[model samples]
Target: MKISLQINASPYQHQAADSAWHFIQAAILSGHDICRVFFYHDGVFNALRDSRPPGDERDVVKRWSELHAKHGVDLVVCVSSAQRRGLLEQTVAKKLGGYQSALADGFRIAGLGLLMEALIDADRHITFGD
Candidate 1:
């Protein structure tokens, strides 16, 4: 099955991000395809490049990056949401003289069109958090 995921919560603030990550791993193991993961609202924090958790704890952002690297999953952060939360795309940040590398590896900032496309193309569209 082709599954698309949308996460609307922050990594540490709620269990939604963790649950979604585990679900994606299990789905891939079961031979399912992850079409895309759309990060909206506070979920955009998961794509922050400089998010540094303790070495003993799980690095949520890195996990998402590795998922994209290993499985070719699309990790998309909502452009408006990110910008609102001060997480700008590299080019936009550079233009504004802000942090240029705000997003982590393998994640891209885009408008809701990509999210709509994923929803339209995937067999299942699963949302985590509010």
Candidate 2:
């Protein structure tokens, strides 16, 4: 099955991000294809490159990065949402004089068109959080 995920909440403050990660892992293990993972609203925070969770806690952002690295998943952060949260892409950041390394590895900043494309192409479009 082809699946795409939409995440709308911040990591740590809610279980959405963690749950989505676990679900993605399980789905892949079951031989499913994850077409894309779209981060919107507060969920855009999951793509922050400098997120440093305490040693005892699971680094959700790093986990996402690793997942993308291992599985070649398309991790996309909504451009508007990311900008609203000050999570600028490299080019945008450089142009705006903002932090250029705001996003983690394997994640790209894009528009809702990408999300719509995922929804159209995937067999299932699952959403996490509000």
Q: Give TM per candidate.
A: 0.98, 0.97
In model 2, which runs have C-alpha deviations exceeding 4 angstroms? Answer: none
Instruction: List model 2 lDDT by residue over 16-85, tens digit each.
Output: 9989999998999999999999999999999989999899988998999899889999999999999998
Specify the poorest-scoring 10-residue window by lDDT in model 1.
Answer: 92-101
Q: In model 1, which regions exceed 4 Å deviation?
A: none
Per residue, candidate 1 scores C-alpha lDDT tens digits across 1-130 of: 9999999999999999999999999999999999999999999999989999999999999999999999999999999999899998879998999667799999999999999999899999999988
Pick the lDDT winner.
Answer: 1
Locate the minimum summed-lDDT window of 10 residues in model 2.
Answer: 92-101
Q: Clash pairs of candidate 1?
A: none
Give residue 33's error in model 1 in angstroms: 0.3
lDDT (Cα, 0-100) at 26 in candidate 1:
95
